[model samples]
Target: MALSLCLPLLAVLLQPAASLYNCSSQYERTPDNSDIIVECGTHTITLEINLCTAQWAGFNASNLALNGNHNNTQCQGSVDDSVDPPIIRYQLPVNNSQDNPCRQSLQIVDEAPDPSGPFSSFSSIQSVIITGYVDTPRSDVGLISYSTDLYYHFSCRYPLEYLINNTEIVASSVSVATSENNGTFIDTLKMGVYNDSDHIYPLVVPSTGLELRTRIFVEVKAVNLTGNFHLLLDHCFATPTPYNMSQSEQHNFFTGCSVEDRTTMTNNGLSTVARFNFEAFRFVQHRDRAKSSIYLHCILRLCEPTNCQVLLSSCNARRKRSLSPFGEETNDSATVSVGPLYTAREDVPNAAAYSNNVAPGKDDVDVAGLVVGMVFGSAAAALLVLGGWFVLKKYYWVGGRSQAFE
Candidate 1:
């Protein structure tokens, strides 16, 4: 009984201890080839170190050193040295097999705090110096040399002004054009009196004022993108309400008249300009000869390309239209199915298989005929030899002419 009790206590004591230090790093190059920036991060801190070098250099994580100022004495932070080794220890030229020149950045993250725990928050950090060593050898010492010392003088937290100033919408480049019959042909429509700076396009109602089934095309342009980002239109909706209402209020009023399309943005230029195009169906309802307009609503979001499927999971856009005057207001929702965004001639279904199954060409037919003729000629020659042997045997043995001549 005593041993059983001791076993549980021993297991609790033998449990593995959690790590206390983590660190990650990324590299970037300036446009003018002036400096290479190294971005390093831990659980609580991030640092950007600039090195003035044109050639690629190596970084050894084992040589990393950090000093923190506490009570006028410098304390060295202890990093967890038991982690697995990183795959890359050196940066090389673009033509080299290991590194990509076009990729100007790298990012790594450490999950645990330093062993010394010098930092409690961004404001608590006083003076810290991080030194990194390059893997290159020195001519005299025959050892690795120090690259640069990065000093942290400012607050560790990212500035609020940088976030606000870095991202903006390009409103001037936004435009719209409509194509009839699901983009089969282009039929430009005149801008109605309702066209204004805020709205994407004007809702033009024909003289008949009946429900005109037509396609609406919207194009949005955005710039100043950082990292791998993709643009998406959440959904398009139309309501029988006035246009003066707020976007949130309008969405609540026309909850059931939304359409979802599989339209994704394309990168038009070098990661700077993003172009988005989507087609929506509009039904211009007429009430008592006065043209009634349906206010359209759409949601746009920029997200990491890999997280698109996760972001779209909660999207409640409906594809099928309701038979009732107002479309289905039920909570049931589904995502629209779509083919590949870009299609090539070779990507067509059964294209290669169909070509292979086609009848043989003239040259192929001629070669096949020659092979068949050769096979038949050989069979005929064998039959003639057998018949000659049988006839000679019958004449010599049955007629007995050879014995009379002797």
Candidate 2:
């Protein structure tokens, strides 16, 4: 009985100590080239540390305007016979990678996780978009040279002051028009390339000034990307019973209790820039079934660059009616479902399965077995000594009985 009890005790005692040495680390960077490194150690080890650099890529965003047409009461595009709105698409470019140049030492939690709230994480976003307009009917003289503001006006339910302030959201803007020379359609001329935040592209000429209305195409580039940090194995416990498990499991409910640091990024010193310039310019003449109304299409392209690995791209839309060629804005609303965010590369490639220092130590299972054996041996020796003492007492008692009989 003693040996059996001690064996289990030895096994339990040796198991935890053998499973030690757990840890994790992460790196984050901002647009301005600043960095934050996080590391946590579970067991003790000392040595030089090294980490590889990661890449940073460009981010993208959508205008979320109902229909690309700013059909508000202010300025409006021409009205058309058909109900379908016009089309407007935007694109943006992003950088590829980020580098990690340093390392640090840290300590991490080693105990088993609590049933609830053991880890927590967060994400930081850097995004940009382009906003511009195209006018029809060549506003200026028949020469096709027109001077006006390429206004893009739209409204959003949420405040958008920050989205509008970034210059990188607006790429280069230039005019494109077909030129006629010697009774033949010759090359094209692009001009009026200027930046105007108050509202305008400053186009000197419209495309095909002859048509009562012209189709102007403005290219808008947008970026919306993110970074995240994660932490693990922190203390977490369910609030004592009597509370509804379903409704109260949320992170907002618990107070004083903290969560594990799963994934996180710093917002300071990191800047996001969005710029767009009219990359392509074209004008279309009014055809049959076309009317005074300008078809405005607000195309939303949503991309989730998961953990900066694979990407998920989708599109949504909104519509508006421009009162002027491209001026007046409309109160129309639109929502785009970009879908769930993508997951990043969580695991490092080809990383060692176990720590190098851990290899030097003996196997945990072997050590456990040895400890169990020793515990059992001690218990057995004690039991044997007790049995022998009992036997000796019996023998002495029998001898004393015989002597009395004699």
Q: Choose the strongest candidate by TM-score.
A: 1
TM-scores of the candidates are 0.25, 0.17
Give the alpha carbon lDDT tens digit for every residue of 330-362 in model 2. Answer: 111111111111111122256443675343245
Local distance difference test, each candidate: 0.29, 0.23
Model 2 spans with C-alpha error above 4 angstroms: 1-343, 346-362, 365-369, 375-379, 382-386, 402-406
Candidate 1 achieves a global lDDT of 0.29
What is residue 406's positional error in candidate 1, in angstroms? Answer: 99
Clash totals in order:
2, 74
Q: Assess the local accuracy of residue 308 in candidate 1 as a C-alpha lDDT between 0 and 100.
A: 42
- Can you list the residue pairs that collide in candidate 1? 24-108, 26-106
Query: Residue by residue across 49-111, what tens digits does model 1's lDDT show?
Result: 222111223223232222322221112222223532112122211111123221222221122
Kindly report which residue stretches of model 1 are placed more than 4 angstroms away from their true locations once superposed: 1-211, 220-227, 238-295, 313-406
